[model samples]
Target: MLHGKVVLVTGAASGIGAAAARLFASYGARLALLDRDEEVAALAAELPDAVALPYDVADRDAVFAAVEQAAARFGRLDGAFNNAGIEGLGGGMAPTEGYPADEFERVLAVNVRGVFNCLAAELPRLPPGGAVVNTASVLGWLGGPGQAAYAASKHAVVGLTRSAALEQAARGVRVNAILPGAVATPMLLERGFRANPDFAEAAPGAHPMGRIARPEEVAEGAAWLLSDKASFVTGHTLAIDGGLSAR
Candidate 1:
């Protein structure tokens, strides 16, 4: 489990991040919960020894400071869940010539650059045996009609994980990425997929498992990666996509 260890999780206010934070806490991790939402404070208060940090992951300095503070409080940095990301505005493939440049950039900033910022700050602080897990998406491997930007950002995250894992292997810091499929979370609800008449049939049908994933299910893979049980694992992207990518 994660007894006595300190784990920092970004996007800890909701969805998979929140689930992972709670799960880690249940396993006795001293949690540092980071999210842009001020509500993270209340959520953290429920845990035995958790600190909620409200900051924008897009801001490199702020992220660095947050990681430093977490390490200082816990006396060591053992693990981190770099799960902060944005879905971006869904856009159709309009001949590829008229894609919205700004929208694409914004998605990259949060999903790709955000991961980089956190890693840049956290890697130096992590002691030997430290582990880091990042959230990518099944779309990173597969393609989506109107999800080009989001998919590309996730693909970049996977690449970052592989490269960072190799670079940090000598230090005993394992880095891995999680590729989650259509998880039932607030983000999915906000996208209105659940309410759509066709969603019920089309969504689950996409995955070979015949169902969308729950956030907690994805968190399970994350927990394993961040634990000593996966000490030999690094630079790998574990797909928790209900066989979506396999199809």
Candidate 2:
């Protein structure tokens, strides 16, 4: 569906970003995979005409350089998936007064500032008919105890997506965000949702589907958004939460 398109995807080393990169490449996109991990080079080797660049998305200068490199490699900037983010130190829900200041700042730096950095660097380079997809979360729409910082940062991403979409619409550069629910990823396992015997069952049970989403499933939505198939879609957050936000 993305044949002949040049695309850049952040956080392309593993999880959803990796899944999306593979799917886009399968659909014939010229890929530029960016991540902090050098392993992304190995991942890039498997795809046809793909380039992997190790980059810190939070660094504005580094992000600009990477975007320039991608435009140079691909000959144009057609689409981008700003999907790099981090869930700050996990903690139980508490009053706003009790939330850790440092944790909130850290999450914002990665989630909000990271998105801003990429958008600033890429927006001007995107030609007419280009598209950009940002990864939000179901938490952006719903409240969760103990995840205030992450939730707020995701909300910011949703806001950024909508505003950017409107601003870029007249240029034919569509922008959107995807709100994914609990996905079965290394991040989840690290957070004790899977590896921790105590929360494993409860985590899956929270979703209406009785399980977390697979990274590839979320990537399906992402791929669609980045393709011409969603030509008229923008300034919206497509939810892939298995009904988590329905309630």
Encode model 1's per-residue lDDT on 1-247: one tens digit a residue: 9899899999999989999988999888999999999889988999999999999899999998899889888888899999988887642232234658898899899999999999999899888999999999987777766677888899899999999999999999999999998888877765537444466468888889989998999998999999999999999999998888887
Stretches of candidate 1 off by over 4 Å are: 90-96, 192-200
Task: Give lDDT for model 1.
Answer: 0.88
lDDT of model 1 at residue 28?
83
Stretches of model 2 off by over 4 angstroms after superposition:
90-95, 192-199
Q: Write the per-residue lDDT of candidate 2 for residues 1-247, one digit (tens) a residue.
A: 9999999999999889999999999998999999988999999999987999899888889999999999998789899999998877652344567888987888898899999999999899998889999999998788767678888999999999999998999999999999999887777765636334656667777788888899999999999999999999999899998887887
Colliding pairs, model 2: 92-146, 93-146
